[model samples]
Target: MAITDKFSSKQIFKFLPIVAIIIAGINAYYTVNEGHVGVIKRFGEAKDQQPPGLHFKIPFIETVEMIEVRTRKNAEKMASSTKEQMPVTIEVSVNWTVEKEAALDLFKRYGGLSQFEQRILDPRFRSATKDTIPQFEAEQLIQDRASAIQGIERRLTEEMAGFPVIVDNIQIENIILPAKYISSIEIKQTEKNLAAAEEHKLERQRFKAMQAVNTADAEAQSILKVAEADAQAILLKGRAEAQAIEAKAKALKNNPLIVKLTEAQAWDGKLPATMLGSGTMPIMDLRNSQEKGN
Candidate 1:
């Protein structure tokens, strides 16, 4: 029994150093997750920065803090007013990331990400949004919303200068206005639409009137042309009749016997029904034979 006890005590003393070495090895190394960086601190002072994956540190002397370097979102809702003193509620979201080069500075200044946001980012974002909202009217906010968003983003980015976090994007998620104001705008727009429709109706009426006047003028011109043509035809016909009468009168003046010849052409070869006493026969060449020779 004494021989067995001596052998167990010797084996136990030999494994003590091995057990301590394994425990120390386990406490010396740490792993940083994907998209995360580790910051090393020695005796509560920032010492060095480490990238993702396995890293070694002095156990119980140096501490490692894992900071997510990936993009993070911070959203806020604020109540503000327009230039017209119209109350509005706006929701804004900011996308940010810790700068790898400035991680140690960030850790030193704010002590952590939460403290950085609370001390710097959130307050500046609220201030920027408040300052911008008062510069715009309610209508301008609705009409030129994109410009409003840009102004807020510019101001926020400007405020974040020299900070350890990078401002990737700023978005205005929602803008809420008073219900009464929206109803008034809708009413005004409806009136404008009605006025535009009325103006369009008047234009159509004017166009129709112009078309009717043009049609009447064209009809008048057609009638005048037809009357002129008919008058010209009548004048030509009267002139032709006068010319025929003048030609007949000229032929009679040239030969007086043409009238007797024309009358004999129209006479019948029969005796008269009755004759007066000592009256010569009608249209007869009753001259004597000696007179005819002279």
Candidate 2:
């Protein structure tokens, strides 16, 4: 019975190679998904990269590492100082993707995404941000954040020139300033707004005053024109009256009978009941008296 058991164990050992071969075959086939590349390594040495598809490898001796080629986002927060030596906390997010052709090389150099981020991406990002942030003062960084973000992005791109990763975009998520400084800025802004409002009010009052002056000038001019017109009319009326008086005096000199005729027209044809000592007698017209005297 022991001989038979030993023989059976030897037989199982002989089939072990077939089972191993079956397992190797099963592990040889790997599918690289979309937006991913498979980095092939043989005997622990990087060979090349394969595109998205089913791929075969020599199973116990060859290995494949799936590398994502799609864009990915990473965020990091760091503490830095401005040119004015003001401390700030900066949060930045980056969009990045590995270069497909350099996948094997990237894998060989940094092993994987986690290792690459630790060794290259995170450190370079922090370095670039720190290097660029100190170039601007705290106020300038706050006032012109676009310029600060551009500077950091440019520096980071430059730092990643020879690396196998493409930086699609970098955004400065937040820049936290000191609470005291923010309060001071708010106070200053409030004062500035108040001053501007006061200036505007003064300007409005000045404009109203100017309008009033103009209206008064216009009214004065209108009154002066009316007075001048009235005076001219009065002068013309007086001249016309004087002219009539002079003509009437000339008529009276030319014809004295006009006075007797006017007096006859004004009389009531009644004799005075009593005559005063200085009163002149009203003469009565006698049509035939002149003929009688002649």
Candidate 3:
């Protein structure tokens, strides 16, 4: 029995080194996934960075921590006051990622990603939003919303420059104001619209009045033109009648017989009841006088 025990003990001693090596190998090597970075630490101090894929470390002396370096999105709802002291709720989305070159410093300072966010990112974001709000009024915040959003984003980028993380994007999702303020603004806008409508109506009335004045002036001009034409026609007709009378007087002066002949032509065949002059009546019919003598 002693000889069998001695053989078994030698065999166990020969396999013990192999078992120890196997255990050390299992603990020495680790794998980092794509889009992740490994921070190797020695004696609780960050010593080196490891890229993705398989990496080895000293067993029992070195440790590895994986941090996601890819971009991540965080949404926050923050409250702030505008320049006009109007309280507002702002919904913002931030896309950020760890700077690969600053990863070690980041890990050393904050210990972990969650700690970094809690201690640095969230506070800085809140501060930037709060600081930006006071620069604009409540009405401007609602009216020039896109400008306000851009301002907030620019301020956030400036604030985050001191951190080890890069802010990829900042989006202001919404700005919500009080219901009473909105209602007041709507009422003011309605009043403005009514005033504009009244002004337009007055302008239309003025235009119509101008049109009526122009029409009246045109009609008066037409009537004046017609009156002038009628006056010209009457003057021309009077001149023509006077010319005919003057021509007849000239003919009577040249030949006195024309007057007697004109009188004879104008008589109707009836004898005058009494003679006004003691001269011969040129218009008397000689045949009638002869018949009366016989």
Candidate 4:
């Protein structure tokens, strides 16, 4: 009986610590921080979610699973650009969050925030990248990269629909092509530049030709003006000579002294042997002397 009593006391002492530990754990409450949500699980399955606050759950049978409630970013690089299989490196990031309404179900299926990338998110990203990028050409993808990234986002969004993951954005970083194609493009551009230069030279020649034509026309006009002036001067000189002769004829026909002088001006229709205006007094020449001697 003494040994049984000693064993009972020892058992009671062990039982007291167990009871205290149970009470303390059951009454404990924890506060959820920013960008986090608390999921209360019963027997390893999610039963309820607690918002950002200090909350309690049955400690022995219930456990709280902490999950990130904020949006998350994931980056992926695609190996090649779709059409030509040119080597390309794509840096793509997606912004995602767990939907508030589906938090419990999501936690139940996916376990925790740590299981997200492998189980639910990364596969969707890979699938979307493979399917969407293959439909686009390498050059077109490089030029319209934004549209390509947007298409990836849309595809992932569609694929992840009805799930707790909400994809916000996707991006494509860089695409690289071969140097041979770039060199070919440069050569073509240089040829076009040479052709443009030749055209400009021809245009300058045409302008110079037009200028030469104008210069010739101006010179011709100046020569014509000089010829016209010479013609007018010749006409005026002819008129003056003719008018002087006419005035002299009219004076000789009206005046007797002038008629006598004009009649004596002729000597057998030859040049005069005696001077007509050389002497101040009357000096009889051949015709008057001959008439007097007769």
Candidate 5:
């Protein structure tokens, strides 16, 4: 019996190291997935970092905590007041990630990701939104929505510098204003449209009036031109008639025989009705008159 006991003890001692090694291997190694990093802690203090994939650590004394380095999103809805002192609701989303270099510092300070978001990120986001939204009027906020969103994002990013996380992006998902303001805006728009329509109508009427005036002016100009031509024609005709009459008078003065010729041409074949005296008549030749006298 003693001999059998001695052999069994020797065999157990030989396998003890292998069992211990197996246990240590199981506890010493860990895996980190893509987009994740591990923080190794020694004696409850953050010592170093491990990148993605398999990593090893001391079995009992060291511990590893995985942190997501990939981008993450958080959405928050907040009530705020605009520059007009109007009440509004804003829904915003923030995309962020753990800064890899700051991972150990973050873990040491906040203990975990959830605690960090709740204690630091959330408050800062709320404060930034509240501070920025009041700078703009409600109408401006709605009209310049994209600019407002960018402003908020910039403010939030600036405020987040105190934290260990890097802000990747931010967005304003929605903005809700009071009902009365919307109704007032609609009324103003309708009035503006009506005014514009009235102006257009007035402009069209003015254009038509101008067209009528231009047409009248053109017609008056044409009538004046025609009247001038007619007057010129009448003057020319009168001058021509007067010239012909003057020419005939001058020709008659130049030759007295022309008058006798004209009278002979005008006379018909007729004798005188009476003779006042027996002297030579005006129609007798001078030679006959001289013989009679002798």
Candidate 6:
């Protein structure tokens, strides 16, 4: 008489495999990576978030979704124009991340993060860039590049205020302008440069002319001073000689013999053949005396 067992040893061995499979399925777990967050859900709906390592959820009924929590790059293109129907092209990029406290909420509301590009990023960024870029001109975009990027950042921040994302910053990489307008501007710049060169040359010429005039004036003044000095010396000498002659004449007024001797001594015996306005008449005594001295 033997007792019947509920399971045979073979059946238990098969059950052993089932039990191992169940255990293995239950043991399926993951670690949330360093810069990532996990969204845990029940029946494909987000329930909670786990951060940075070792997480477990009900194996069959619960689901976990991993999302990158680090900052992400969204490189984009934008354009604007000067109201004059001018077309422009610009390259833009943004650094962004999910708001930490809102990660779980975002996953829950936005259908588990599959629609980030569509629901959150694309629309919001497009709205921000379009709204802000159209306000600037082509030249303004080139010159105020930093300000343009800042505008995009500010607008994106404002647009995403109700969302669970943060715009770390915006970068405007480059701007392209129309070829015709740029060429015209370059030509105008060349003309401006030529005008500046002409102006500089004229200024130099004017400076040189002024220097020449100043030098000529200085020389003329110096010559006037020298001529005045020479004339003054000649006048002084003439006055001294005239005074000496007058004194001698007064002294000779009392003595006639001394006058004759003075006249003889004054003669160099080179007398003129004719006197002032003389009619070739006899000036015999004066001629005879000068010839005797010679």
Instruction: Tell me the number of clashing residue pairs for each predicted model.
Output: 0, 0, 0, 0, 0, 0
Candidate 5, 173-203: lDDT as tens digits:
8999889988998999999999999999999
Better of 1 and 4 by TM-score: 1
Q: What 10-residue stretch in candidate 4 is worst by lDDT?
A: 266-275
The list of candidate 2 runs beyond 4 A from truth reads: 1-22, 224-294
- TM-score between candidate 2 and the true structure: 0.72
User: Model 6 — which ten-residue stretch has the worst lDDT?
Assistant: 1-10
Give one digit per residue, the lDDT tens place, for model 1 in 132-184. Answer: 98899998888887888888889998999988878857777888999999999
Better of 1 and 3 by lDDT: 1
**Whole-structure CA lDDT of model 5:** 0.88
Model 6 deviation from native, Cα RMSD in Å: 8.4
Over 137-203, each residue of candidate 4 has an lDDT whose tens digit, in order, gives 7667867888788788889989888887788867675555567766776797799999999999999
lDDT of 6 by residue, 1-294 (tens): 123454576678878988988886776776888887888878877778889888777767777788777898888776655546687776777888887778888776776445776778867787777777777776666678777778888888888787777776788777778899899878988999999999999999999999999999999999999999999999999999999999888888877899789789999998666465556565544767788999
Q: Give the top-scoring candidate (TM-score).
A: 2
Best-fitting candidate, scored by lDDT = 2
User: Model 3: per-residue lDDT, tens digit, 1-294?
Assistant: 999999999999999999999989899999999888899999999988888899899998999988889998888898889898888998888899998877888888899799988888888888887888778998888788777767777888898888888885677788899999999999999999999999999999999999999999999999999999999999999999999999999999999999899999999998875545666754444666788999
lDDT of 4 at 115: 83
Candidates 5 and 6, the one with greater lDDT: 5
**Ranking of models by TM-score:** 2, 1, 5, 6, 3, 4
Off by over 4 Å in 1: 1-16, 203-294
Which ranges of candidate 6 are over 4 A from the true structure? 1-26, 78-80, 112-114, 203-294
Model 1 TM-score (2 dp)? 0.67
Residue pairs clashing in model 5 are: none
